[model samples]
Target: MADGTTDQGPVTMLATPISLDFEFTPGVAQSKFLRGLERGEFLGQRCGTCGQVYVPSRGTCPTDGVATTEDVVLGNSGTVTTYCVVNVPFAGQAIEIPYICAQILLDGANLSFMGLLQEIPTDQIRMGMRVEAVWVDEAELIPSLASVKYFRPNGEPDADYDTYKEYL
Candidate 1:
């Protein structure tokens, strides 16, 4: 232990840092979803059996284990199902601390997607808040979630809690 305290005797520990580089192949569902992001749009997979939609789907629905072959285009705006204010720092984190990370339930989608919420103070962020995607510049569009810079309030009325209670 770093502090050198143990019940029976002193314990020795080794610290190791290992890094590996590997290529990733996206599955059918992920390929489609990434393509939509490049076009500055949101895409989700619709499960045939459970009829639930998932963002960045795993090519199948976890609920029914059914192939989610249907592609559903989702609206950029959605309701904030829940959120947390991050105050701790970690490795490879680009955003500053004290930021809001939220689970947003996009319109027409059955699942919530995680995104960074900004343009509002942490104390002001609330559940059922209406928000919209803030995409990167057109030239920076890519096949990744990073294409959307962050989410922000859309100036609409707060959503009724009933609309997003299931997600919370």
Candidate 2:
């Protein structure tokens, strides 16, 4: 110990190395959804009471507050309901910042799903722009949304904002 200072050894201690390991046991609903993704399909559960559909296959419906059992496949193409330009970098994000992240309403489905936008100018990304899923190659199939790489403009005319405004 110093003359007038108390015995405060080190300012900081060394941090322990971290190792993360865990197995995910998917529930029946989640297992089915994952299997569908491996087959290049988008699966959602439908509410029998109100006919509302949820992507990622929720076991319950938010609208009617009831359990769902019906499985529906959402189409690949849809209209962009809304979006935000991500100008900040994030850990584990594949693309750089200044890219657009959008909510798309797939055809034949009543809900929207969030995805990345590409193959178009960021400035040209507007609400209601028609976009389609860009799936990863068959050899890269995985039980995750990342199986679909991203969404891209389909060269279709943009719909009016009012058309999908309520979905936002």
Candidate 3:
């Protein structure tokens, strides 16, 4: 037995352990995309039936319900379909708070990827704003989306809301 101020058994407290060793084996589609990233290219797979393009490539097309094999290079520039200001900090977020995160539909690609918006104020970020990828330094190329530093405004006029509204 133990008094109120002392413990007779092991004392336990709630704690979460954090670590950084993360590794994975890529599937067929992801393996191809990773190879492309190593070569400094963006790879996409086109749906055989619907002809829709999926960037970062997929093993199968969701629309046509079939495997896609046609690999294409998505353009570096795209239009921001929608966005949000991430004022709240989150785990594993590389950038600071009050940054704009956006969904961009690259030219000639049907699917869009969510990425961080940079080189502009969060207040200036709007739907349909033209943007382009900012590649990471040449020495830092890797098999991941992190290869692209971020997307920034390209000084082009904003697109019509209706033009990309459905993408949202």
TM-score attained by model 1: 0.86
Query: How far off is residue 50 in model 3, in Å?
Result: 0.4
Computed on alpha carbons, the lDDT of every model, listed in order, comes to 0.92, 0.86, 0.85
Candidate 3, 80-142: lDDT as tens digits: 998899899887887888999899998888888898899999888888999998888878988
Q: Model 2 RMSD to the real structure?
A: 5.2
Of 2 and 3, which scores higher on TM-score?
3
Distance from true location, Cα of 29 in model 1, Å:
0.5
Rank by TM-score, highest first. 1, 3, 2
Q: Which stretches of candidate 1 lie over 4 Å from their true place?
A: 1-17
Backbone steric clashes in candidate 3, count: 0
lDDT tens per residue, model 1, 57-154: 87998989788888899999999999999999998789999999999999988889899999999999999999999999989999999999999999
TM-score of each: 0.86, 0.82, 0.83
User: What RMSD value applies to candidate 1?
Assistant: 6.6
lDDT of 2 by residue, 35-111 (tens): 88899988888899998777776688887888889998878899999899988887678787789999998877777
Worst 10 residues of 3 by lDDT: 1-10
